[model samples]
Target: MREIKILAVVVVLTLITYWGVEPFAHSQMHPHVDPANYDFAQADKVSAKEQVDEKKEALEKAEAQAKATGNEKLTHIPKSEYNEAVKFEKTINDFWASNKEALSLTGNATNGATLVQANCTACHSIKKEGFPPVMDDASSAAAYGVVPPDLSTAGKLYSKEYLVGFIKEPTLASKVSHKFVDGRVHPMPSYSWMQPQEIADMVAYLQSIAPDKMTDKEVFQNACQRCHGIKYGDMLGGTMAAHTPETNIKAYMGKVPPDLSQYIRSRGAQYLHEFINDPQKHLESTAMPRVGLTKDSEEKVISYLEKVGDSKKAQREELGPKFLIYLVIFAIFAWLWKASKWRDVH
Candidate 1:
């Protein structure tokens, strides 16, 4: 009976800790956050709807102004703006909806090779194919504010739709449209004049030469090493852009992007996931553009971060079950001993 009482007390305390105290403490410390929505198509729909609504609101305001001031021409400006916004929304929607079919259209890698050499070789390099940038890293950085990435791995690192959109309209594709406004332009000029088939062919040529599989470290290097550095231990040496010099990057970016060495531990995976998906969502007006990594690529990048930042995670997980088992055995022996002692007392 006494043993049962002690066990009951122990269970009660454990239950309280597990169900009440622990959750409360965690709630105060970590606070719940919604999981990131990785569906880009859904996100695009939401953004388009929001943009349409904003234009509608502006049209209403313009109508109100025309009524108050009796200047009918004033309404023309907002009316035109509203119509443009609606058209833009439709275009974006159509692009996203037909993206798969567009990508499925077979491309001519041979023609793609010629097209890329004619158009892209000036600003970009294809190191895998022995095509170097027209200018050295320093000269390119000075001219373009940042050295363009080598197209060797771009085909594997980014999504087909993203590559297409980026080539068509860099500012819009990167989600930095808000910052580059009123005649301000992104460094990469829009290639909207290129035929859709031509763009598809370029993407095909890139994919033809890219490796089938890339390690997590390689993924990070291809996607992020241009703007952010990993300074933990000798990790910086592993980055593809390590030769470009951090000072030039800092100048181009307006500020030196934070070292991502401990970001997984500090920012947590969820925040990083969403932030990478769309930088403007978390930090408004941030210079970091959307990286446009596919779901698989993003997960690989996050996995690499964990490997770097949480090196002991595997060991910790391995030991957890053993420790719990040891405690359970010890508790059983302890209960038996207590019973033996109290058996004589009673």
Candidate 2:
């Protein structure tokens, strides 16, 4: 009997710790529905407010189980899976050093291509004969139903500028890519809006791709075969956009919100940069979360922004300034955003 009671106390305390301790240390939860007037302190808060009732019921079950027996079978309760996610922070930081001289985007195109082959090709294959996999939302690209396009021939299909633009705002592709079809899924999100140097490197890879290496159709099929089809984005177009930040923000996209296809159409690159680093400051209704990109990531991405907004060209065409250009333009803006954040803390 004593053992059962002790176990009960432990179980209860564990639940309390998740509710209290976790919230106090790390969290930035805003009301899932209202983007504006949301709290940033809940970034690490584990309480899934979007499904509050489900969680409450889960806690009750645990409490009941503890009351009845010493063991816990609270299977209904779901906790964060941060442990499973790729630690992009550390990895992206190391990415620069690993490919510094060879296939390095920080320098020139040829170097970046090598890095892309080493890093991106494994997940996304650009050759029909190469055969990577399909986007399936699972291990294979088929998991998301997207077919990765062939980078081998993207150079001929699109220009270097076009490639960079696609990476910056993938949705900008309707105007940028050879494929008129909308091909992407909920899980097959775009990396164009992601870190810039990486985009540059990948663009450089696309630019260097030789058509003699593979056929365009095969390249398209092989490259796109690993991911979901283009309809993925268009299918959920409005609903996903309007969905609560909690549901839409990082749930589908990365920690940041999805505005590249939509927001950038109206707002400029400077706005996008500021919003990327600090979304809450610009739009009170934004559900976006800052990923704390490194200085290099910020600079590289800003440089890539030039390519994304162009309404012309399906292939390589230099659009915006190289990576650092946006950083230089938006440095003051980001600084102001930083000051605002600091002010809020005090």
Candidate 3:
């Protein structure tokens, strides 16, 4: 009876502690917002195709005006005509702001395929099935001192918005230092000249063909494949020479970069974003250069890392309350049994 009373007291105290602290812990861990303050339902209400059509019309009108003025550069166009372009861009931006997910959900893959073949195929390859080199890796290495990374899994690797901004300004995105020598000085040039419609189509095309879902495996392959290796199934993939032959890395970066299979778990998403955006910010004189990934890309990368490191976190969180309830029920049963057994003695 004494032992039963002790167990009951322990159970009650445990329940009290959990109930009292769980809300605070949850609030700290995941802040809640009032849904009434935000119009989440508006996302579904807006038609993606309608928005795209409106954007196309606006671009066409501006292009026609630019052509009449005999101006090859859109920037050289008259202010009155340019304001029309800016107006449409703002409309789309505002629409996307309210419907954040619509941007990725929109775009035409077929048109994007044509645009990609014309502009991107010269450097990037869409084929991801095998480790086949799209361009002459050996020749590129000889010329540039390092081969360019493949874009086969890029759609799965990066978010739509990040890709959009990057395609617009590759130099800004990479954030390379002026001192970086060889071909690094002349990395992929910006395609800011492309029309808004063309950019959207290209982004759509990438997303359409990308893996229906992203995984940590794809994220590592796209971002870290050139410098890191991790075993996948029976084959040992990625660049084995990443660490060894230290002289090769030192020639470019002054140090061999570390493996990042467990980086997200250790460093966290926020840190990873800062590091990717500007490595010099965290560790001055570090060899790692700023990649200039946008906010969307950072989010996608973090999501992939979470899958790799904490796949069961969601399930565990869901079961927590059920487990607590079971413990309470067990305690009650134990208390009842003790009471019945002592009834005659009392």
Candidate 4:
């Protein structure tokens, strides 16, 4: 009976910790957030189609209202809604969907090279083609507030759609619309005026030079090393070095980006996914812009993070059950020992 009482107390404490204390602590520490939608194609398609339809519907409604009121002009339409219709006749997403086919069109890499030389060499570099940035890292950072990434592996790192959208509108493609609002000019100007064939040719030129298969470290370098550094082991000195100095980044960004050495363990995978997809969703008005990595590229980058930050994850998972079994056996032996000691007391 005494043993049963002790066991009951232990169970009650465990239950309280598991059901009450743990939950309360977690709620305080990490508020609930929606899981990441890893399906970018589906999400982007649906969202873009919806926005286009909604805008078209609004414009049609305004026209109908104007017609009913005998006003040939859309004078009755709300100025804000009218402006939205006119300004965003086709969003970046819409443009991407419409122009996706151009990716397959045959293009001249020479022509693409000439076009890039003429327009892009001022700000960006095609290191693979021996085209260095017009300015060094310090000069570039001072001039543009951020060092432009080398386009050597951009074809492998980013999706074709993202490249197209970014070429069309850098602010919208990178999901930094908020930062560029209220007449704020983005550092990279919109190339919406460029012909679709020109955009496709640029993408083809990039794709021709990028490696077909990249290791996780390579993915991290191409996708994330421009801004975030990993200070784990040799990574800081090796693969995870940022292009620009930390001081320059801090001056431009107003804060040094955190070392991502332990971010996998600290923020967890889901938070990292959502945060990377859209920084403003997690931290409003943050300086970090959406990286626009494709699903595969994002996965590779996260996998590399896990490899560095949680190197013993597999070992820990394998040993966890063994430790639990040992604990149960120990508990039983302890109870038996206690019973023997108190055998004569009652």
Candidate 5:
């Protein structure tokens, strides 16, 4: 009886911990829809493309009616809608302008180098010659579809704005390649909960490191393919082994790297760029190391990921709130059940 009570207490406490802490942490740390304003049913009622199509059809019908009736009244979308869109655009532009100025004031490659060492080197590698201190390609490939890329020339490939946006919110960052037609979750975690200024500094460091010229495919093949295999079937004309032996990887890092086949679908370009620039800072004690890639190199790498990985990352992320709400309801019911069952125990 005593043991049963103790077990009950433990179970109840564990559930409470998850209910109270994990969800709260998730809400605070992860990007989620605004609870007060977002309506999932309404959001799903029409996609942007569908909405545009409907408007076009309506306009066509209106034009036909006007032609038959000889009415010349101009048809226009609501001015307020246009004004609201313009206002949002202006707000975003202003936000970037201010951030860019701040970045200029504080950003420098020399300082960025130091910052990279403190925050980035653990999961990312800048040079191709030396092995990373921890996990290597073989083990990484087994886990994430590819080993992290080498970032010797990232700045030349991506724009500074892209770098900044990615650093601010990795999962929300734009993809350089194909758009997601099917909804799928991204694997890269968000680091936006951290200090915004630190993210800016990392972006500056990456910009400073980019080489003058390196194509996206070249960057992926040279830096990424050692851990990640492109499924396009022997791009090297069947001359090289697609993957390194597991034993070769075990000799160094004791694990195979993940495949990056759908990395862009799972982690988006900005997220990948920032993650390559600094993984440990975002996820403490993560097995992955930083690759010391510049903005351009990172961009190219992400473009390749977008080519292969899940395309509907944004839509997938959109479902996070729904999951959280479900968890919250489950937690409440669990608490109520626990209370009822243990009412007479104490």
Candidate 6:
């Protein structure tokens, strides 16, 4: 109860200090590209044809060599011939596959042959140029006739989740999204059977099978941006790194909160070096949580926070002019807003 109350007060003061200041991580960015589409049709044809051909060629060569072995028998031939025949077939298949094409399905498309059998064969057959439709429209796959979207570059076009989601929960996204909203609709009719995580993992593996140019930015924005802002300053108002008065922190916490900035600056970085390495050792009953941070992340966070002071120093030269401009703007806004209807709300 006591600690919670102290925590609540700290949080409240932090919020009050923040007022209307915006966090740094939120970007008013307009995205320039979409990554939720693929072409499974082309992929299926290439994959199926290549696999079937490899298997067929192996079996044929095996049979042919059996006839030539002069044992005059093919069935239970000597182990050497049988093994050689198998090896020859495998080498041929491997060489062909080395150049033919890699699996084109989405990361979640499937693994080895199992995924190939389930998703690839469902809508496509290996063929060149023309093929039966695999997707009738967007919401559903082709009516078992129209060519499935060419899958050769499906893995490359969209993200892993895009492919996996399309497979397990096609309704989430598809060859086309309009059908789900307001176009010629094609419903697959059922998908209550697949586990979400399995599909996600499958997609991850599929996407990784091919090369990718994805920046960590995409992953960060997609996962962490909502809860924690993107940039360092964005975490606690650009002011978080400021030398928040130890008095102020204590005022908020009912105890003399440690002055992180002073500890960082005066002890020649060593104080912070020890404090961050083990805060509990330096200050017992510290309100700071373990944060579950590892040594590396803790080091990185501390190093960056160390910048909180340096960044201020770097910007100090401009503060005078910037402050003047802000004062002018504040005065003008105050004058204008003083007469505005909103000012008299009380």
lDDT of 1 by residue, 197-316 (tens): 888898888878888999998898888876777777333434333435567777756687888888999987887998888775667568888888888889989998887788777899
State the displacement of the C-alpha of residue 169, model 5, in Å, after optimal TM-score superposition: 1.5
Question: Per-residue lDDT for 262-315 in model 3, tens only?
Answer: 566677666676566555445644666544343444566666555655566689
Please write out the lDDT profile of model 4 over residues 1-346, one tens digit for every residue: 7778988999999999999999999877766654454444444455445545766677778778888988757744454555664454455446556666665667667777777778887899888889988888778877777788888888888877678778877876676765677887877888878888898888778778888889888888777877788887333444456777878888767798888889999988888988887675567568898788877788888888988888788999999999999999998899889889988996
Worst-scoring 10-residue span by lDDT in model 6? 29-38
Task: In model 5, state the lDDT of residue 39.
Answer: 20
Clashing residue pair totals per candidate (backbone < 3 A): 0, 66, 0, 0, 45, 33
The sequence of per-residue lDDT tens digits that candidate 6 reaches over residues 238-298 is 4232122333434333454333433334543544544433333344335432122223334
The RMSD of every model to the true structure, in order and in angstroms, is: 6.4, 21.5, 14.7, 7.0, 22.8, 27.4
Taking all chains together, each candidate's TM-score versus the true structure is 0.73, 0.27, 0.47, 0.78, 0.37, 0.23
C-alpha local distance difference test of each model: 0.79, 0.42, 0.57, 0.76, 0.53, 0.40
Ten-residue segment with the worst summed lDDT in candidate 1?
Answer: 234-243
Superior by lDDT: candidate 5 or candidate 6: 5
Ranking by lDDT: 1, 4, 3, 5, 2, 6
Residue 289 in candidate 3 has what lDDT?
50
lDDT of 2 by residue, 1-346 (tens): 3445775898799988999877665444422222211121232121123234454555666768766886654433322222112232233224333332333344356766666666566656655436554443333422332334445556554434435544443432221111223663333245634466766666665655555444322332332222212212322232122212223233333343233333334655556555544453454424333323323334444433333333333333454445457766676587677678887776
**What TM-score, to 2 decimals, does candidate 1 have?**
0.73
Best by lDDT: 1
Which pairs, if any, clash in model 4? none
Top model by TM-score, which number? 4
